[model samples]
Target: MSDHPHPPSFDENILKKVEALQEKYAAMGQDLNAYLDGLLHADYLTYWDYINLDTLLSLQHPITPFPDESIFIIYHQITELYFKLALHELDQLNTSASKDPDLILKRVSRVNRYFEALTHSFEIMVDGMDQDQFLKFRMSLLPASGFQSAQYRMIEIRSTSFDRLLREEVREKYEDHAPGDLEELYSHIYWKAGAVELATGKKTLTLRQFEVKYDRTLLELAENTFEVNLRSLWNGLPVAAQTDDLRQALRWLDTNVNINWPLSHYKSAVRYLQRDPEDIAATGGTNWQKYLPPRFQRRIFYPELWSEQELANWGKGWVEKEVFGVK
Candidate 1:
């Protein structure tokens, strides 16, 4: 053996080969680009040119000269853009659900992921802006709040029955004609179904019973909608490929149903309260904690999708558990 181990020799040939491959790849990319240019025509390029990145970026308006305000504005604006994109995707998904329920569920699950990202992003924003800095701009945002976000409202309206009821309640509070047309339509369907059942010597249902039945039917429809999506993902698969996408989608829906929106609303309220305590009393809006009612806590959008054991495993303690606190 030699006194010192010989160092490994550098392979100049190997280095040369790597450089040659890189050049070849670069040339191939250029050729591919030229081919794509020929295929894509001038209209696509003109459309691309129409995109005004500068104008889009100019929308960030900082009310205060505070350094953090810039950060705050950008972060929230980014979140709103994300919300817009998610709403677009959800709208498409909802349309698909009307036809291909399975595909829609997958898309809805993806949208839920976006919501999760937004929730986490808000937490980050809270951390970045100290209490004092947030207070400076908080007052500037008076009546204009996330509650007035049309896209958010649209999402809630399209996704849940809650919006319909809430709208009706608002209309009733204003002493306006109650828009019970939907309720009436539901009643008509239920009565028709009941008549068929009665003719077949089955139990006849009252209007109230029919309403409950309608609710259950809608809930089942939602479940079926979810299931159809889950089944599509499970298609073209062996046992191993059938992963927990369905379970994850269900969990996401459960989270949204139980906590997501309320949690965000609560956070927004808390941040506002932290900045201005007096505003809470003046505005007649309580702290975020109070907003989470017992009913809201236990709300599940698609309870039938979950089995008894799954509910127990999730520590939800059955459907009857109150919202604010464990019963």
Candidate 2:
């Protein structure tokens, strides 16, 4: 034999794979040879091409010429992308054929990881930009606000019972409301309060635009995930699989999304928007004081996992230490 191994022929593994592909294409009435030819001609994917990096980089078209405006735009885009990843994990769990607690634990942990990454990266917004640049460029953007992030809303809608997302004021009233009344109940969703004009107590143009675009989609998601959401799924799981680790994972998720995440935003708001007794309105005219603080919303995803004290204190410690500097 030559020093090199004999030129390879179609080995058993290669032949088996080819046969499998042939059968796969045959089942769909496709010619495997045609696909093989196309595959042969296709260029190998590069990192940039695979991710559309150029397209993604080109997306941040700031309305103003300020350099920091790009930072603001890119950061929000990144936040939305992470929210999409979280929703992807939730979607898989919600639509799964079986309520596997291990899967729930795995997916929820993944969402937690995404949120933690976001919470840490939020430092970019908190300190990276010059406040003057952000304040000026933001004005040119008009009634658009991060509050309009539909994916974030979808994540909440798919996380728990629809009523959990409603404000405490109307939640009791609408908790038992029929599915047919989704639209009516949505009218009182907690986030709608976040976008009101502080002076007038009226819907800001930002909220109106968000509602018009997302209300139907959010309602549909709420209905579809009604029985399959995390809270409902946990309720239906067998006692054996409802392990302590799983409960802890969910509690972490609840804290990550509701408490830690919002407090980070509230921290940033205090950095950029906080003034003495009179603070500046956010670009979208949102009341950042009321909106960013978790103590105000008190939104929780899995309540049964938390105790009365935890619920009562909800986000109070973080606000005290980070925002108020009350060591």
Candidate 3:
């Protein structure tokens, strides 16, 4: 025998076979339409080979054998999946919004639907679990608060009223212009306000009609402008006005504020807390009473976009009419 022993017989044969197959496949036309069409209509058993649905479904794990525990686990798991998808969509929207800002509204509407589903799902969870029943598993979830979710944090940051630090972080990462950026964005608003004033010819239209018409036009402009801005942002491209960036940023903030539907959650928490104080203590000592603030109010995401005095006057008139039945 030669000094160099023969390479492993099986490995040599496999390598040869793979190379031969690669050459054969390469010789075939590049179009895979026929192969993909067959894969699409394959039976369930064969579907696993193409998509691995079995492996995906097998991921649900029940930590406890208790009948109710599975329901509890599955509900949260499903919500988590929804949250994941929402985050993915938001990121895609953000990228798209950067290039074509008009799409932001549509993207945000999609996100809103997910939030609605999340809100409804929570209601179902509360309805299904009694205070005592939820308590049994609540303690097992120590240090796993939803507050810690990074994706949720991203959603919150993008959608809420601006936090200076968070805004700075965003600007740093995205190459956004800072102080001048605010002025640029406000200029757009000012220009729009002037246009509204000019269009109305300073003639006072009834508040109801004015609001309806104004909102329609504003939303239309926002939708169109947002698409253009989004396309730019998505491709890391630059636009002339930094105000466009600010408006897009504020849109995310406004949507974030709208999505927080916390009042319902607070009420549900209170109901559960009344039933299972012990479970609450065991599951990380939450004081539901403290959690619920004395007065609940919706927070504004874009305070600068509106004239507070004008809004207050409108509110006063509306309240007077409603209270006095003067309408």
After TM-score superposition, what is the CA distance of residue 148 in candidate 3 from its true location, in Å?
2.7
Best by lDDT: 2
lDDT by residue for model 3 over 161-266, one digit each (tens)?
2222122224234234333344333222211221112223342222224344454443333333342333234334344343464565544434333323344454
List ranges where model 3 is wrong by over 4 Å: 1-52, 93-99, 160-260, 276-279, 287-300, 305-327
Q: lDDT at 71 for candidate 3?
A: 70
Give the TM-score (vs. native) of candidate 3: 0.50
- Looking at model 2, which ten-residue stretch has the lowest summed lDDT? 276-285
lDDT of 2 by residue, 125-192 (tens): 99999988877777787777788899998888878888889988887787676678778888888888
Model 2 deviation from native, Cα RMSD in Å:
3.0
Sorted by lDDT, highest first, which candidate order results? 2, 1, 3
Q: Report lDDT per candidate.
A: 0.49, 0.86, 0.46
Find the 10 residues in a row with the least total lDDT in model 3.
190-199
Q: Estimate each model's TM-score.
A: 0.51, 0.91, 0.50
TM-score of 1: 0.51
lDDT of 1 by residue, 1-327 (tens): 889989877699977875776677687775545544666785554543577776877898887677777886787677778778766765564333344435545667777877777766666564677666666566565433443344543444345443122322242333222234344332322122221222244433332344443455543443333323333333423555444665567567556634654565455555555445554532223223432332333444444456777544442333224223447
